[model samples]
Target: MSKRTTPVVAGEKAGSKRTKAEEPGIRILGPEEFAVLVADLLPTT
Candidate 1:
């Protein structure tokens, strides 16, 4: 298994800001990070 650092908080994007609707329990992830997360969720052989 790989090590995971403390997860990211909401609206932590490089140049993006938080929107009004995302105020409630929103967790924002970057493109690469999101891809990694998706890959991690896949089944491994």
Candidate 2:
């Protein structure tokens, strides 16, 4: 069996610091791109 690791939560850590350019977990997708993503995920016969 493989060992499991804890998933880290997003946000700045205690005593940690961030700069103006340090942004995480941000994404923007248009409708057409989202539709393509959904289509790729669908199971094929």
- Report the number of the highest-lDDT candidate: 1
Candidate 1 whole-model C-alpha lDDT, 0 to 1: 0.52
Q: Write the per-residue lDDT of candidate 2 for residues 1-45, one digit (tens) a residue.
A: 112322222244312322222235233344566677779999999
Pairing residues by index, what is the TM-score of model 2?
Answer: 0.41
Each candidate's TM vs. the true structure?
0.41, 0.41
Residues 1-45, candidate 1, lDDT per residue (tens digit)? 112323443335443334432445355576677778989999999
- Worst 10-residue lDDT window, candidate 1: 1-10
Candidate 1, position 4, lDDT? 38
Q: Could you tally the backbone clashes for each prediction? A: 0, 0
